[model samples]
Target: MVEIKTPMLPSNKPLIVGKIDVRVGDHVEQGQVICQIETAKGNHQIKATEAGTIAEILVEEGREVVANDVLMVIDEQGKIQPEQQSESNKEILTTVPTDTVQHHLEKDLLIIGAGPGGYVAAIYASKRGMDVAIAERKKLGGTCLNIGCIPTKSMVQSAHLFELLNEMDLFGIEGDFHASINMEKVLQRKDEVVDTLVSGIEYLLNKNKVTVLQGTAHFLSDTEVQVGSTIIKAKNIIIATGSVAASLRVEGCDLPGVIDSTAALDLHEVPDSLVVIGGGVIGLEFAFIYNTFGSKVHVVEFQKSLLPMLDADAGKFIEGICKEKHIQTSTSSKVISIKQTVEGEYIVTYEKDGTTSYTIADKVLMSTGRRANTNGLGLEHTSIKTNKRTGEILVDEYEQTNVPHIYAIGDVSSKVKLAHLASQQGCVAVDHMLVGKHPISDTNVPSVVYTNPEIATVGYTEQALKEQGIPYKVSRFDFSANGRALTMNQTEGFVKLLASEDGTLLGAVICGPDASSLIAGVTVAMTNGVTVEQLTQTIFAHPTTSEAIREAALALIGRGIHQ
Candidate 1:
């Protein structure tokens, strides 16, 4: 079997399909001129490379197609193997020199980069009955599944298990337990989890009949994209190429022992001592993971507090947790240089409070931040707007770019580089395209950090409210007083809620056991305008961590069941 695809014109725009010399179910001999196309250079004939029967005619005579757009499919009389259909499509040529054409049909939508944002939007759009096609050059489930979220969480689980081995006595369980991690097995398990999710994405895409194009995609035109040998044209396009791990512009950053978050996840073995630069989400997450894995981990940050982007109290609270976990943190510090020693240790130099300092470690990780991956996307030729500083595509509240039909979601455009936010933005963009109205507001988006006790926050932070001088009531319910937390012996952080004077739920931040799961209820409340009184009145099972939320609500109302 072979595909008769549309060859490109002199330019990458759509070619006007002209004369059609063949029809579906028609047998044609070799060297037959099957169709003619109107091209930018001139008119040209599309020919059959070998004798074949036309199994499909995907385009009308008056339709338009770009190069590598599939115009027809042919049974090549066994001359070409079915496996070579792809190569045959690539080989099909137009009469002109600069362009060739071949493709089955145009899609209603084309999404570039199959990351969380792209895949989620793809599935959602498919459910909306849109014929979607997604192009992923590498793995199916971009960074979150393959490198960022899933892998880091898997490592965290193993590290937590190892950390627990030393604290068994605290739980009233006694054993002369000795535990160690086989890094190979740990990495193998992470890969297994990632592979399963990636395969699941493929299954969903296939089940939805969305064309899964596997190649690095480049924009051919505002409405057309080229992936490998195929040029795909769609009514709408979404760019969801997620960000990549960026490094610090310091000396010796590219040295052998220096690594990024992705490299940090797949280390051959946990280093005896590690220096993590940047106190942001990525740096701190890895810092805690390696710390629990028995590595002497130290974090250096340019900001005044850890997680500088989050609330001040959240940073301070997590700082205390880091200290309790023995993970050294150096804030208000800037990494100046990293030099290697013959002894195989790296001496990291930084300046803090106008003083120079140094630390030695077996490995140095740069978790500074990520840059927008817009290079080689061919956006330079288009009028699509982008952020001048970050180079990320600039989208409106509806997730639509200045170019109406091109939407940018996820890390490619978002200021907040979170997987869930990306997924949400994706759905919003799809909804905006189909219905011209987005159903959800991004204001109540929830964010969680997978720390020891976890940190989850939704809606406004206390700092933002204060800075804006918003009238709000605040209450903090310490987990120390919660029966469930006390019984679980994991009471460490508190549940804090901010509400309006009249009792409308304004914001929430949790830093304790089940924080990740507990934040969902708080987010729902804040999103749906659940008031403090209503939340307190809502039935929460006794002795459950969720009771802490109701207690916090009660505390905000001037009288509390327990404080």
Candidate 2:
């Protein structure tokens, strides 16, 4: 008997079975197209590896399947043999007999959702000599590696390189270069980077001797989970089921040309025009990307500014930069509806200042945001608690839920959804579970937006200080005055510092080149409770982007030497 299974795709997400070309009792030849599978990139035809009679079809059309999932079984010469099945095969056929006694595997820890949070916890717990098992419904790296962070940044880098090549004359390098965006090659490179990182994660999990179960896991009890048909009795279980992209309920949102961020990443061809419905981090990143790739990008933001969560100055600076780049942005606007024309173009209707306006585009990207995914986890069976407003699992500072033995972390928890934050929470949760109670705080978490100039912030913002009635002093250092910024010809933003009257470093925000990397210094200072005086005393390298940070610190103390 030959078992036909689903082939691995570049994406970690499951593919939907599109069409079945054969039925049971049908004769098939080798290399024949047996079925079609729909992936994010496009449709793919599944072919037979060998000639045989279709003995049984295990899966049906429209069903989502992951890599190595059995689709059908073929019998050569129409003969059936009774042979001992391998252990791996037994795990795949998870359904046990009703009349047979159900077997349960015991583990010290069981983690649901093998995202950054789950896998990090698994490895940390395993290193502490605790047996760990992680059950994941999709790929091991979860959304951040497979879709969110790595893949998007890969495309961002490609777009940045493409834009830089077009403006090489500004760098004193004169060359007649004809460059166009090759989306196919760009996607291929993104897939290669994702696959390599995923493989590395899998290797680390295996090296730590953590058991990886491939299936949906649900809570059977406070200390037990059912993955497929296998029951795992664990001393503790951590829920890390990340989040899903939010859906817009406006008209024409379900149309073919309208897609979410996930679909946006897999686009093979650059559209002539793109309408982005949100002005958040994800929306702005894609706006800059498609715009740099020669698309006329229009961003309609419900809020009055781009990056509403960021400082007002930062948002205004980015808005100005967007205008300079020929990217149209409509602030204080609400998308009323979207309509598709017969010619396959999209008309996006939005209201701004109580006046309705329309923009035409080849495609529409909904970058609204994401919500915690806790739908089918069987949380009702346990005493686990969730937030009514946000639908996120409620956890204590130690990352523990109402039930002491079961905990929740990452996007599932009512906390920030960054991958690095999730990983840190995972480590902290493991420490609390195994060693002692050491709660992790979210105060100093760094936030970064990967726009053209990039924006990063740590600690409290100036607005927050004013709202809280805290006395704070402000210092500013524009990258325009920095030697490195002038040499790079990318000076467009500034580094602002908010310090207390007593010299305590309250916060720092950088909106220029390498801001993402520069914010780490501020993060370290804030985490260690370092004051502005201490920061000013530290020597920064000459002609570097990070020197702006030290200059901002010096300005706070009335010691600005280089303006």
Candidate 3:
């Protein structure tokens, strides 16, 4: 028996463009308005392009419909006319038996989650001739794509663009410009980027012949995982389930106006004023974006400083910048309770310096930190253990768990929560499985904060050296001294370097324009164990922001050319 599938469309002939109106299995007659196509011009009524019951609507409403794409199908007395491409179906009709073409489920390596880590493991392991299977609970790409990093970054980009336009006068560009964000459109573009990338991941998984399962994964035992009751046996398993936003426990914490960092990304309307709880990376970054977007942002952090792991001086620099942006920041301010007002606002009560105070805002964002999603995975059934305080899985340098056959490589295990670290760990874990030795450490990994000026750091902080009793010399270069920064009118931050007494490069912090990109060269140097002398020896492009790195390195030895 042959099954036919076709996309339903309007009979307007020239084609009316709008959102899809009919759903799958919706019966339709000739010339019926089956779907609404939204064109940039406006919505257009799409009539039934065929005379039959509606088989399916492949796309959703509010989504643009394109020509030649399968919109839906119709069946006239079992004679199916599929409007979409059917070449693959014809090939299957000619050369393959349905029973014979069934995919065998056995795999040598099975990974759970397809975020940065899991997908990388699947690709790398598959390249090494391992049969790979990846199970994801939702979309092919995990939280980073579907909810967290990608979406938030896109919003940040938009906010930054708005900021740039607002400051165009500094560049001697004169124009009367006014722009307002359409929140729905901003979110639509983010969704588009995520959809494209997630679909790309699906393609890569299929190209690698990795069996993709869509369901929750659980450990059936040490060497096996169960996904939707399907037992997948493998020689080894990699658990890459990532972290989620950590919420604080306080009165009225579950109020409707309160949201996590991820939830803030999906908000339809921008709040008039937002109170951000926790001044960590996530909180500050969002605060910068929202402040730029015309929201009155007030940040409350329990710690005395922002980004506590960063250098104290660096934190001060960020505080200064936040002040310049008119963002209200309070450190050592602990929230005691959250109450919902009759006006639908959130009243946040807090104590600081032994005094209780309160503030009201349309919304409160919880950005304290993230904890690993280890619950409900049935890990208690196995010998694997997790840290009681943080719930992070215990893993050796080789990314191996207590059971040799199981490996963990992500927020589920490591201190570094960045996505790139997870991808690298995934590769290292696979290599350990194949090579039987060698492992990687979280040390020397570069961390970047995507705030206005952008902060990127790598290796040891000066505090770390002091704590470890490692003798180190400190050096610095200010963007105010750089010719490029002077020209760009962005001389607001500096680069600081910490090196050993013997001049071995230890770590560096960059806080300035293009800091995210500028740190890559320094990161590469640190990763390759390059020395300060080697870094200074390499000529940097003159009048470029990157030359600051070289200048900063030269300052370590007290011979910087510019400073």
How does model 1 score by TM-score? 0.82
RMSD of 1: 12.1
Please say which candidate is ahead in lDDT: 1 or 2. 2
Name the lDDT value of residue 445 in candidate 2.
88
lDDT of 3 by residue, 178-274 (tens): 7887889989888877865764576567677898887788886776677774678888999999887778999988988899987888888888999
- lDDT for 294 (candidate 2): 88
Candidate No. with top lDDT: 2
Candidate 1 stretches with Cα past 4 Å from truth are 1-105
Q: lDDT of all the models against the reference? A: 0.86, 0.88, 0.82
TM-score of each: 0.82, 0.84, 0.84
lDDT of 2 by residue, 12-98 (tens): 567899899999987776757898877765566677777778999998999999877899888876532225446764564455344
Candidate 2: clashing pairs of residues: none
Per-residue lDDT of candidate 1, residues 285-392 (tens digit)? 899998888799999999999998876778999999999989999999989999999999999999998999999999999999998888889997677988898889
Let me know the TM-score candidate 2 reaches against the reference structure.
0.84
